[model samples]
Target: MQIFARITSPATQSLTTYRPTPSTISFTVSTRPVPRTLPARLLFYLSILVRIILGILALALLWAKWRITFPIEGDISKGVRAELTTWVLGSSAGQAATRISTRLQWRLLIPGALGVLWGVCRRGYTEESLLVLSGLGIQTSTSSPTYLSTATTRFIPTTSIQDIFIHEAFKGFEVRFYLAIVVQGEEDVVVVFPNLLPRRRILEEVWRGARACLHELQPKSKF
Candidate 1:
């Protein structure tokens, strides 16, 4: 079985070592990934395309000659905080011009809203958790151990581990992977990493490490 001896933890910003019962296999799962595969590269390009479309729509609004007023501006620690207030002035052509102005505002706002939503959803993909396998059972924790009450920290016996697999899936705008540890009579435990390391290598290494750990434990043996 393939084993990664030293793996870096993106959450705690430290190296993590796993030596379960003398037979040790470990690897780090970081965010940055190398996508060389066809489908992986395709997804990466698709995400870029989405971002470009959003940017074009934003530029179109700016080019419409809307009156912009900065109603709020202040000094902060290193920069100034400001708000851009934009509006369209009705032309002298009467009610028809007024209607057009209102319509333009709605048109700009609709695409703007979609862009914001897309960005928010994309950023939500970064969440952190760690998994440790040992002789007696599997231990999981958030990097912040003191926040155990609010985090996922637990020990599941080897027998209780129902399904174990590495999920190489796209989360939002990123193509990240996670160790999906499903336990019997319990919800699955997913150890996800932030986007801070090589993507494909981490996926392959983590999958190999997790599989090695599971192989040693022999938890009903699911791929």
Candidate 2:
């Protein structure tokens, strides 16, 4: 991730970026990731995909869990099972696998499904973003944990937005700064970067940039 301008706190260990354009201002914070190359990113996702596929295969195997001799004639069932098991799993390993599957039943499938779920919850880089569009509106979005899920987003039109400002609140024991947008009709204010909750300096920079972009105003002369 490229950080154009930011204020990092060793205590929080957050990565923040601010980008302003002629008509928009955007700010984002990421709590994960160490900056990867193109190939590395591809490989990272590929690894996660491979793990999910493996978990799926584990569950699929239960569906085709080698019926063996469950419905065959009593006397010849063993012989037929031995032949079929050997044909598929090859000699000793085949018979052993069938026995384990028969004994475990759903015990095996549950683990595989849980493994897949765990993979789905492992979000490599968690990011939260705030986007302000000059005459349009403002939006807040949180990146999804896994590739299977979509980002969570909310958009408030410019008309509904009453004001945007920073406020202080007790997060744990220390007071942290957060940006909030007051909506015209809503009882609760919408908080930006809810998860990341960057420092005040970063929030102030974003506040200024957002106002300048949304109002089409240039900074006053310092002199």
Highest-TM-score candidate: 2
After superposition, candidate 1 runs with Cα above 4 Å error: 1-135, 145-152, 187-189, 192-198, 217-223
Q: Please name the candidate that would achieve the greatest lDDT relative to the true structure.
A: 2
TM-score of each: 0.36, 0.64
Runs with alpha carbons beyond 4 Å of true place in candidate 2: 1-21, 36-53, 66-103, 217-223
Lowest-sum lDDT 10-residue window in model 1: 81-90
Q: What is the per-residue lDDT of model 1 for residues 70-162, given as tens digits with 9 covering 90 to 100?
A: 233346323432222222222333333334434666666657655654563453222343454544456554433222125445667767876
Worst 10-residue lDDT window for candidate 2 reads 1-10
TM-score of 2: 0.64
**Candidate models: Cα lDDT each:** 0.50, 0.72
Question: Residue 24: error of model 2 in Å?
Answer: 2.8
The C-alpha local distance difference test score for the whole of candidate 2 amounts to 0.72
lDDT by residue (91-111, candidate 2, tens digit) is 465555566566665666567
